[model samples]
Target: MTASTPSELIARSRRLGADPRNTNYAGGNTSAKGTGIDPVTGEPVELLWVKGSGGDLGTLTEAGLAVLRLDRVRALVDVYPGVQREDEMVAAFDYCLHGKGGAAPSIDTAMHALVDAAHVDHMHPDSGIAIATAADGEELTSRIFAGKVVWVPWRRPGFQLGLDIAEIKRQNPQAIGCILGGHGITAWGETSEEAEANSLWIIHTAEAYIGEHGRSDPFGGVRAGYEALPQAERRAKAAALAPTIRGLASTDKPMVGHFTDSDDVLEFLAGEKAADLAALGTSCPDHFLRTKVKPMLLDLPAGASVDASIARLTELHEQYRADYRAYYDAHADASSPAMRGADPLIVLIPGVGMFSYGANKQTARVAGEFYVNAIHVMRGAEALSTYTPISDAEKLRIEYWALEDAKLQRMPKPKSHQGRIALVTGAASGIGKAIATRLAAEGACVVVADLDLEKAQSAAAELGNADVAIGVAANVADADAVQAALDATLLAFGGIDLVVNNAGLSLSKPLLETTEQDWDLQHDVMAKGSFFVAKAAARALIAQGMGGDIVYISSKNSVFAGPNNIAYSATKADQAHQVRLLAVELGEHGVRVNGINPDGVVRGSGIFASGWGANRAATYGVKEEDLGQFYANRTILKREVVPENVADAVYVLTGPELSRTTGLHVPVDSGVAAAFLR
Candidate 1:
């Protein structure tokens, strides 16, 4: 059997895309051309299979490859007026697709089709970009890959770029690849293997040239001692600095923040010339689209208090915004769209590391990853020579490009709670886990907190969306731990919109048999813990000036007495009363507090997992296996309470349905008359 036409090309694309050093998430394109029978005419014709726009090459499938008639795409070159018409070009490219199943062809489809070779690979490899974007890029290109590669000056990518590449090819038919100044590199070959090999050779050759000729002391300074701190302490430090950064970066729309303390980030921040390099520009144009043109440099003095940091960040942010507006006013054309919010997407702090902010976690992480890659490229470029990238004016054009804006405008609509953040306590398993999962499913970023760090992380992993949920180890009974947990939440997701106080232990004992330790543990977790978390969350919400929700998971014992449950009953009642008081006190700040009273949730619950179900069953003279049925019979509706039942009630209270309702109690006990709300 003959080998497939584009399978080798797809394999090569995946190989290159799989490595961030080669391409930063969805940032490159690949193509292959071969003779195939036309589906409609059943005649042999040239077919170009190119990577589709907005698809990641690392995960690209055959469906993601847009098949276009090579002759049809190449013919546009003759009639196309040499003007900047990205919109028309995109429409024309889409119109040329040979089938309806594939997505729109890549913006660079014309350039790929014009290449004489049967296969082409174009990527923003860090090594190639480092060499291609340097101060003397053309001179260095000739010195490194003489005769084998052609150097093309930077031009805005479109019909004109395609024509330029064709002209370059005409001048040098033996050229294996071309380096686009301040952009990226392109390599071509007669086969997919040859193309991939040539691309790797160019990249590795550039890397080797830099390694031999680059500066030895690119980092400028020794590693800081703070970088050697324990992971927990480092995280806490990052958390301490997060609220200030988030507050400063907030614009018309709030931003979510992600902090990084990797060795690459720490080393980059430690460099003496870091500030100067960061100010130059992004390593490539695509990076500018994600992380702005440059990152904001922050100076965090040694041992600065949280308040001092906040004040400093706030002042610096005001100045940054002012400078950004000035830049916009200086360069914005009459046709340019209104300027976006003047907040830096990336922020670099000396001791704490870097923070990337976005409208959500995914965007923020993308910016962070790109910056991390930039660090490597920048260092490599600086070592070889003075690191130089595209000019600020060129970056601004790409940033405000009409076509780029349209891509964002075309995205699907966001969910109801798209940007909201929630913190759920004791979320490693059971009721808390259910609540956390539900909140995430509803489009809210969630912090899954528990006393067990491993279990908490496991629960978060099970949610399977790292961008939407994170795990933190917190013991609600300890005020410091609770505060740290809250800070971590703010650092990870920007702000908290909802607080679920659901971490509690079940203590069902006779009043005389209850030990002091048991009494203290119950009150510490159920009463004092709830108060601490709520107070911390309320303060944050008040600071944000955004109204929020606080839901307490109380029990039926708060309203109806149960035998031998004195301590539990007392604490539950205290928690219920605390909700009412908090509702009244926080009302002015637009913070709502409510309670959910669930009678018996025996399965998949921590209380039951720790033998509480059997204990309660023993107290009622019933078998442990029959406990669920016994409780179901006790309720008027004759139904057993489940974790999901409570989760649904909590959702209703936290969602828009109860926006005007507060200081109220909702019962999820399958219709228990005695525990019913008055």
Candidate 2:
């Protein structure tokens, strides 16, 4: 048989009517076989493999086995399965199985496949099965197997199973195999002879339950549960009901059946019993396969009107749908199954718990199990007056949740520079200074970064709250200084947050006159420095989860043509886009980022005193004095845009007020929207 994954095997077993209680304790394991490194030969060798988890030898497949090199196997006698105490088994398996044929050999597999060897036979003895099926399984198993039987309770299977069994065997050399109640038994030894004997011993022990209670079938007319119905009449009725039922179900064949075991089922199905018959269902839950684990307990009154009965049943179903939606949404993370809107997975009438509708056998099976399991748990719990399982809210969140997967994909992870420390390079004046001053004014401890230490210090001094301001001098164009600036920022404030890419150098030259050296120089300070600050801030912000923001004070020259400023314009445009990509990648963790394009700030401290004012003023035949107003009236708004106006723009972009907006460019250019619109 093709070996399968543990999940597949468990699924198949459930199809064979395996009980969850039995399956959960069956064990979890996987196996594989191939050539692997041989410890003794220092080369590869071939071997047959089996893992410890597949004690159910009949259904075990090659996929459930693990291989070790033949030469390596002999050398591992002392370290293989059956040689160590239970606690030591896992360690030994890990050591011997380390990278062996790409899997760890099952502990028992070692002795069965090689050592005490033979075609190994291993099983959880019948003593365990009987004990586990009994109410006092734990106490009884302990008492009977004190020293002779290796008794292991519910635990993860595979290496652990082998290790525990080995320990038990070590204590009782004559013991056949461990008895795992609820799970099955495993019997293994050299030569099929020893293995067969062990198997017989376990079977003989369980022969008692078989002798007293076993019939042709363990779940025998247990069908007396459905015997009362007139076969011919009910079959016709069910066939007739199929069309209506199938319309609402996903399945083509609706497996219609009845119940008559309980007093309630019998009384309801007898006489003019549509009212009573509606309540019957399965005896136990298989909800892992079924849906909600239990179905509706519908019992219409004998004298009630048909319309009233239908209305009441509909109401009950609606309640079930609401409650199921709530429960599914609550516990499911990203691992639950998909659901159609408002459709209940299973519907139980008082006598028809397992007769729920579905789209397919798998779905029907799922619904059946869901209802059955629920009945077991609920009835059992109620017997003890307890009500507990996963909560409804949890189930609904799982059932209705849309964000678990999409949110992660759509939002970039928030970085740590997100909200802790603020850095404003070139902050002594202009946009940089505005950003630094603004950040300081609004709760952020600010670092006034500038190439001019004196100016930076003066600016910090002006802020007055020195505790929140730090003046640092360094040409960001210098790599060493940039690193030191980062180190200083981190050292001073413990970490960094907002990084305003404000520091910049302006060099204007026509495209033909823009030399490589001149281009590199401007690019180094503006583009390169901005990239460095962003990289540093990204690291710091991600660590904090505070999600810091990065704002670039790119120029409008980044867009429209400007006289004799080719290098600045191209780089500015590129810088604006770079901010866009960063925002895309960092928005997930709550980081908001944006850029500001300021046209002209003649009144800013960063502007040159004589040459800057004169040169710009010469363009429109206006004196240095009327330069700001001349440009103000040139745009659609016809109003002079001030340094303070630009400052306010930056403040707004970085504040909580604009938390949802990012990767946006707000131009502080006295109504330049017309140019773009045109």
Could you tally the backbone clashes for each prediction? 1, 83
Candidate 2 whole-model C-alpha lDDT, 0 to 1: 0.52
Worst ten in a row by lDDT for model 1:
222-231
What value of lDDT does candidate 1 attain over all alpha carbons? Answer: 0.83
The weakest ten consecutive residues by lDDT in model 2 span 277-286
lDDT of each: 0.83, 0.52
Clashes of 2: 83
Residue 419 error for model 2, in Å?
7.9
Q: In candidate 1, list every pair of residues with a backbone clash.
A: 215-383
Please provide, for model 2 over 404-453, each residue's C-alpha lDDT reduced to its tens digit, 9 standing for 90 to 100. 22322454543312223577888888667776767666656678889999
How do the predictions measure up, each by TM-score? 0.93, 0.38
